[model samples]
Target: MPMPDMNLLIALDALLEEGSVVGAARRMHLSPAAMSRTLTRIREALGDPVLVRAGRGLVPTPRALALQAQVRSLVEQANEVFQARDEVDMSLLERRFNVRSNDVFFGAFGGQLVDTLRVHAPLSTLRFAPEGEGDDDALREGRIDLHVTSRRNFGPEIKVQLLFYTRFVALAREDHPIFDAPITPESFVRYDHVSVSRRGRAHGPIDLALEALGLSRRVALTTPNFHSAIFSTASSNLIVSLPETVLWGMRELGLRMRPFVIPLDFEPVQVVQAWHPRCDKDPAHRWLRQTVKQICATVEERNAGVWPQP
Candidate 1:
């Protein structure tokens, strides 16, 4: 088989992303005719009419939409392979990095991560995006530099580093009557609870464990994040099943928690920092990973005794 022109991949990536041959031409500094010819070649090489006219605008076929992200990632990785930077030069590095994570992580370690980055990369800006709808697509498109989540099932190709493991615990106001004594499953199920998740998921691993034991709790309220759940607990008798790490800001967030005496042995939640494997050897991205890993280690160290001391 003859080697296809790799330049076509780069052009197709830009063309499909821009959705306009003229735009892609301007981006690549190529003439419209040259880019159109390149697009024709990409169509032949890929054996698809990748882009087509829709009214007055160019639109991608389903094939082009599917290939857009994959092609861009491949092009970016190929560029890195040919000119990969071996070392990070922080003093002169000026870049903006976007990290996708939940509010729990921001409340716990975003400050420390920002502090560390400020000291070294003076010109670097860090942005945090919440786990909104379609956020994973942002990561796939290279808009998000890093993603931190306890949720697994991110595709196998996403490069992942274990940051830490977190487990769910029951929480309420410090002076709540429940904390005066050992918390039994019966007692836990008696109290009203708050549901937490970006989608306001009313059930979780706790519910499953309870179901196994023929128990269930009343969900009094549903909120999107841990901060809201904890804050709500501070004013109401409503209990919350939250990750142990969210307790880190209890003194600051004004919430407290105690373990159930009839504790269910639930799966440990592994929090990981994930990125596209295309970023694995990129120096700037490597620095970002190390920086985040250090932040996670600091959080773990600072809250050492908080997790179930066993």
Candidate 2:
């Protein structure tokens, strides 16, 4: 057997993308006659009428439709491979990045991130989606550009960088009864609590730690995000345990909330930003990762221990 013409793959991509002989020819800077001959070669090699005549326009066949995304990915990767590493012009970039994150992250750095992008990559658009919206392989399949989260359930091949480490702190109104006395394990469990779990799980390391001490707290409410839990604490006696970073600006946001050290042993949360390995070398994606990392570092440093220790 002989190797197939690799150039035909490019022609096939163009033809499928344009869906017209004249359009593909214009895109590739080729004559319509030459583009038609190339399409014929592509059809012969693939054994399919990749594009069929529809009344005044061309429509992709089922096979072409199925292969459209894969072919586009291949072409893009090939282009990235050949492009210069330092060739990215941020001002001219017109790409959209899909970032999946929880509310805690958005509360911490969303505004700063948007400002940085507007000044640097003005043509780029950042779409921040809530958690649990995409499939398991959303990052791998290129549906999501970045995952700024604490969860580490991604595949081993995914590139991950620790953005920062934050420990859990119980947040409540500054004048709540829990703060009237020393916050001990006994006093901590006396008040109702608000739990933040996307899965609606009310118990976690805090509960287990309390269990080990022969004590457990009642979770009166369970919310899916930290923002809701934080807000719920503002007007109620509910004590909510959240990452220290999430409550950084509670006072400035006019929430009148304060964080106290939980009287229990717990590990620090490793907030990380993850991406597919295919984007490891892509300049724009790399910039996004770096920008996020920088923003996290800046916020952590500026607001280090924003709330007073109780």
Candidate 3:
């Protein structure tokens, strides 16, 4: 079957509304003769003389009357589809955004994120999902809205923006004997350590740094998250290494721990927020991204002197 010209729908709608060919022509900025030809096409397309002569005026046929409401509705919907979405009415926005991030990020900035949303988008909710191997797939499939973590090559398709940069710091119980003496490579390797690894692998950059100095620390315990490692270190002599941002968050939560430099040249980790290309222009998603960026900026400002610059 042949496709009908969509232009005819507009002409038909004008013709039915105006009733007179001259009036419809004026409404569409067309000549009377052009409108008459358009009505002819609409009749041919629909197999009906939608408007017919009635004395000195014209009236719509029963078929045209039946289609009047439907045509107008479709045209209105099409207009909305092409409209600009640069702004959103926050109070009217009722939606749930799923964010995937590690516990450290949540611990550091999640409270601020919630406070911002409460004042701006009161009705919207945030759902933070744990990071996993399927985060890329979840983002592509629309199962997740944003992915926040350390920056890595997520191929070329994912959109990423740097939130902040952080480096690891050694943490231990506040009164540990390590604090009584000057910290050096030798002393750092003397304490039994607690390692935090999501995959449960013991060795990391610290081990490599120690190996360079012909020294190694015993990893007495390995936990999956910074919270567990902090809890373990607070009550025991086991030392743990964690991002400076995570340690700051832990301090805010009243965890008794002390942070010290690792005494090794380690690259700073670039923490970033990532999203799928599909959500690049979504107003709600844009707002969420901006909020996260603002929170990170605040954190950076607050810790200007504490966290060393790269």
The prediction achieving the highest lDDT against the true structure is: 2
Go through the candidates in order and give the clash count of each.
Answer: 0, 0, 0
lDDT score for residue 310 of model 3? 54
Candidate 2: stretches off by over 4 Å: 1-73, 81-84
Model 2 earns a TM-score of 0.78
| Model 1 lDDT tens row, 43-120 | 888889899989999989998888787788788778877787689788788899999899889988888888988898
The model with the greater lDDT, 1 or 3, is 3
The lDDT, on a scale of 0 to 1, for candidate 1 is: 0.82
Candidate 3 lDDT, 214-282, residue by residue in tens: 889899998888898888889988999988877656546686667889878768788999897767877
Instruction: Tally clashing residue pairs in candidate 1.
Output: 0
Q: Better model by lDDT, 2 or 3?
A: 2
RMSD to truth, every model: 3.7, 4.9, 15.1
Residue pairs with clashing backbones, model 2: none
List model 2 lDDT by residue over 3-93, tens digit each.
9888888899899878899999999999999999999999999899999999999999999988887887787788877874865999999
Please report, in order, the local distance difference test score of every candidate based on alpha carbons: 0.82, 0.88, 0.83
Clashing pairs in 1: none
Using TM-score as the yardstick, the better of models 1 and 2 is 1
**Model 1 stretches with alpha carbons more than 4 Å out:** 1-6, 29-49, 55-57, 132-141, 253-263, 304-310
**Stretches of model 3 off by over 4 angstroms after superposition:** 1-84, 304-310
